[model samples]
Target: MFVLSVLLLIAAVVLFLVGRGKERSASGWKLGAALSAVAGLLAGLFACVHVVSAYEVGVPVAFGKVGSPLTSGVHFKSPFTDVTSFSTRPVDLNLNDDDVVEVRSSQGGVLYADVTIKWAVVPAKAVGLYRLAGSEEAVEERLVLPDSREIIRNVFAKHTSEEGYASAREQIGSEIADLVKERLAPRGIDVTFVNLRNVRPSKKLQEQIDKKIQQEQATERATEASRTATAEAERKRIEAEGVARANKIIERSLSDKVLYNQCLEAYKEAAKAHPVYAVPCGTDSNGTPVIVDGSKSG
Candidate 1:
């Protein structure tokens, strides 16, 4: 469009110059020039306009040198310059089975991790980013992905296979994001978040881990049962001791007269209920009487 407008302006100039030498055709040539000039101006106006979306930032480059960043909305630049847009919103880069990362665990086991990283180009440094990283695609290829792989390896290396598989998986992701951000922030990439979707150890290691977990659970149950049984036994022993102590107190408090009176009262109460078939044995030196069965006397 800019080229066409420039051509139209040149044609208008030629027509106006040619009209100077003509007499009868001069008015027609002037009118044509005026219309062409208006059309050319409109075309040039349209050519220099560029609209940056709300979620993007545009960097203008003229003659291979970067210019001021163009924020969202309409921007005007020389027709010869170029504007490149980079997304300012968070972008997700998934590292899954198609591009899985392999790392070694603290236990020296091989592990596979599927991760995703959310990031964006810092708007303030977008021009610098373009100069250094070229474009958004280039930034991801040259910086985000490689850094993500390296960070994952470094973070997972600090954890055992079981930790990577389950226990510290979230921690590993957070550490990776932090480390990657620290490393890439200076390079104009802002790391927002990282997700470790799946991290798997070898099948053999997984089976061993499952068995170990089951064994630990079983041991915990057994320990709890033993503790309960020991508590019940202690309780019974205490009850027996209390009963024996009460019996001893009763025996020590009773004298010959008290024993005689208690035996008489017991005999009266028993006689009222049924026939008495026991003989009162004489008191011992302890002054506690004993009963002798009449049926066994023979």
Candidate 2:
């Protein structure tokens, strides 16, 4: 504005100096004066127009009223109109991973959680977000950051330390994602990811947890050992029973008379292979191979 005013003053001075005497010719002086004012006004108007950037979208407003949104590139509007440019690209928010959230477990113990989430503004919802939140700072302040934290806290509180730490990790993240999506969907934002970075128990509780796990593992090992020992004892008992039953069957099949008959047959078969001389002493007494009265025996 200052530069334009200076140029206009100079133009006026030059016109005054050259057309001072020509003022007597009213028509000529008026024409010169009119031309000078026209040039100054044009210069001033050019100075008032600030260039709308190509990397941004401008929201033009007349007086205090906002008009239609403008796409990036070059555009012309009234010099006095207000233009507010907004970003259409994605904006990333990085949250800390060590933030602790307090939650009461099913056992009434307090659980601490540390989590991190990476997210961005959805492109299509940028306009609606701008309308509600006014700016990027407002978006985080009013919607994204607060709601994300709320979802995390809500989901964390429902599960115990062990459940939240390992067992229900996927479940918790899914719940958080769902909650965020539902909350922000109306406002034109999408919850891209909800990550559970870490979960820690209290120091005192940690010691107890470690001890419990160890005890459980030891008990399982002992049970397995007992099962193996019992299996071995049962196998041995079955083998012993089988051997005893077989022995009883064999004993029942053998007899003293059978043994005596087998021995007589063996002796008869042996006598046929050798020459023998015998003299019988007594005929009244029953004698079978009695060698005491025999004179010679084979």
Candidate 3:
């Protein structure tokens, strides 16, 4: 606008000087001044017409041919040309995952799921994406989100409820992220996060899963009890065998002659301490008795 105004002002001054030098009428000068003023006004209006914005770069085209995109500062272009503003900043897209749909599992169970994915267009490739995919909505509708849903369903379908909740959740999340990146990276959208927020199975399936878990736990308990009983029985059997072996050793160490000799020795020791009692020799109740007929010994 400034350049065009200056050009018009110079033209008016030139016209005035020439008309005055030739002694032309003042009306000619007025006419020339009016034309210059109008030209300047129109030029200024044309220059100020297009948009110059922040966080935006204009893709300028001249006569239907692709021109250089305007950088992050002030830019001026022809009034008749087209300039498309492309945002250079990151865009945050929140895609709600409620699709109002139910999918059946292989086990005759119906699974209902609500999940969200965070994604955005890579700002650098926005123009190329627009050219190829037409619009961000089009890109999402055609390419990015469908792939996301497919990846999510594929990952989720492989897991049981327990697996989906506990061990396989991280695996599913990682797989979804990988799958989305694989599909979206080529289309210039970066998938930052893919999360499985909520997954619900049919009520009947949930009950079945619960009952199955309960039965498994009961089986485990029964096996544990049987192991304990078997161990106790083995311990008692070992103890009984030990006692029987000890009794056999005691029996082997005893004899009738040894018992008789032990008794005789004890009786003799007692009789020597008490001599007044005449314990008969041959038919004595005591096994050892004092010998009163020692003089008749032949």
State residue 298's C-alpha deviation in candidate 1, in Å. Answer: 21
Global local distance difference test of model 1: 0.86
Clashing pairs in 1: none
lDDT of each: 0.86, 0.68, 0.68
- Candidate 2 weakest ten by summed lDDT: 276-285
> What lDDT tens digits, residue by residue, belong to model 1 across residues 215-298?
999999999999999999999999999999999999999986787777888876765666554345356676554554444446
Q: Which one wins on lDDT?
A: 1
TM-score for each of the candidates: 0.64, 0.61, 0.61
lDDT value, candidate 3, whole model: 0.68
Clashes (N, CA, C under 3 Å) per candidate? 0, 0, 0
Candidate 3 structure quality by residue, lDDT tens digits, 1-298: 6588769978887877777776658679867977897898787777756765777666666676656656666666776567676554544434444572254443556666666667776656666666765555676677766777677677767766666655566776787678878878877777777666656666887888899899999999999999999999999999999999999998998785676666567657766775433443333464454544333545
**Candidate 1, residue 296: CA error in Å?**
20
Tens digit per residue, CA lDDT, model 2, 92-114: 55554444555555555566666
- Cα shift from native, residue 40, model 3 (Å): 12
All candidates in order of TM-score, best leading: 1, 2, 3
